[model samples]
Target: MAVHLSEPDRLLPVPGVRLCAVAAGIRYKDRNDLVLMELAPGSECAAVFTRNAFCAAPVHVARDHLAREAPRYLLINAGNANAGTGQPGMHAALACCAAVAEVGHTRPERVLPFSTGVIGEPLPVERITDVLPAAIQGLNPQGWMAAMRAIMTTDTVGKGISEQVALSGGTVTLTGIAKGSGMVHPDMATMLAYVASDARVESGLLQAMLGRCADQSFNVITVDGDTSTNDACVLAATGASGVAVESTEDRDAFEAALLRVCRYLAQAIVRDGEGATKFVTVRVTGARDAREARVVGMTVAQSPLVKTALFASDPNWGRILAAVGRAGLPELDVDAVTIHLGDVRIVVDGGRAPEYTEQAGQRVMDQAEIMMTIDLGGRGHDQAEVYTCDFSYDYVRINAEYRS
Candidate 1:
């Protein structure tokens, strides 16, 4: 396999994070599909995962591992999502983690495993185990690009984002990488994301913060409105910064920066979605509260009619209204609605804005990035935003024969 990189391939160094990428070839023919991210000892962790009742074995196993030990390394593979394969799947996932722990000289509980692709088939632990030594030897700061690329399946580009934040001990850096393209939605975490930071944060608090941040970030984005069985997002801190940040100001700054990195990569994931052409940003306002607005916003963004029109570049506003009416917001006042495609302003106060013109709507739809805003007309106190992408026939083609 050729090294096809993405816009997020730029190299970055976060103080405590070390990455290694090697070809395990779990399902892919030649390229590296397994990545090992080794975080320094004393590193804290946070995670969010899919709410899908039938989630993969590794998803549950990793959560249990994090509960038992502070994370030291993460083992991930693509092209073989370990989902729906019964008892054997659990054993294989545990074995993969054990192999990594053996190499790191850490307990198996200190390692987490993640897998993606072809549900129901057994994940070949031997593939990763055979390559573990070389994978470890390949470890370094320079492998960020390769590590990010290794996690992709249908994603045309690798997604990574980095930033630094100030804390009580000082300023520490955060780095993150993620992958998702087709089976995307906003329940728990809809895809895979791995993040590490150098700051000292408590695992309990960091997990809580990560859940909240993703609820507003990953949980709001939709690609085809389908949730994946392999969705996993984890945050690990190496405590290399020597700063214990507990103050509200310090925590908020760190949280904000973490959110920034996650959001950037999440958007990039959607942008590189299989067969994706246009990136869509949906913003909803005027609901009674943020929750209500988010429900309505995601409902609109996930509508097939809405996305299909996007693929065709057809300027359709009625589809948007139809989605909102059924959004389950309880007595949603249709009369108090307004919508806009970017700045074109299509609907005004429940009806087509008098100035609505096909030419203007066409201009708005033509942009590479499309923004659709809705005003429920309540107050500024309530608002929600989501990100998604246009659906095309290529999306169908890619997933139809995905494992074949």
Candidate 2:
């Protein structure tokens, strides 16, 4: 269970968006496994996808459709990720888009496809297209919550947020939903997410903002340190509110809001990580550059020994220090390093703190949430924070028998 997350009571509806979810029996039974979203005519979108070279077929098709034109429809399914299926998978994804265009009265290129779940399996195009009519016929503005639930594969809770901000001329509302539990070392983004706003935005500017928001949010989180083959984060601006967010001030506010929502969703993924029992935040400060800081933070966050120690509530500071030392920082000053567990200092001047005691560290580790801070003393001002979850026995059991 997630440490501190609950299903949202309500989701603020965004103008120019209609959504619906239905079960097509693709993989799951008696539950929704498919979702369809319709966007307004003037909607503009920006997207960031996984860096995995073996990404799913829908990722390729979605990139192509976005490049050709703004998408009018988003067709997503969970249960069977159309990845590792080679050319046949590409054909299956294209067929699904063509079916959506035929039903929605739009060009095939105006549809973007997304998928998540088990890889190396062929997508059941027939099952998905069979329910397109019902999904389209039942479109409603209040379907965000249902869509959030429908996208789940292993997620323990529905993840979503809604916010309204006053822009230059009017109030613009933003709503977003995400689904992820494992394979969540986001390279460019998370498993699957869609954020839409009713404000008008320039296409190029929206794309740039997405990259910046992702760097501070999704890209910094890890669950099992395994990047999935079907990770995507998309942002859409449907211009139905008549609020033009083009000025510097407006852009900053919008970008900040976007970052907040993305960060919330990213951390929720960690909290609900496969069999996760503890949520951990790893912070690396005083680095020479952002790249090195992230390297150090991620090294600690992804360390199996460190995660295991966290699960066991063990104050094993040595594992963290060893991970930091192996981060490949060529100019790292061992003498200037310091480590802290929450507010309790564990390491000082490259050795155990003279005033530190094991009991103090253990107390911090016993909490449901843990914070580990690593200070690279006397370095340039660069820091990074990475969110992760403790490794537990259920994590192994879940993955080992996943296909069964």
The CA lDDT of each predicted structure is 0.83, 0.92
Off by over 4 Å in 2: 188-190
Q: Indicate the residue-level lDDT of 9 in model 2.
A: 91
What TM-score does each of the candidates earn? Answer: 0.95, 0.99
TM-score (C-alpha, index-matched) for candidate 1: 0.95
Top-lDDT structure, candidate number: 2
Task: Give the poorly placed runs of model 1, Cα more than 4 Å off.
Answer: 1-6, 188-190
Clashing pairs in 1: 43-237, 81-116, 81-117
* Candidate closest to the true structure, highest TM-score: 2
Model 1 Cα displacement at 249 (Å)?
Answer: 1.8
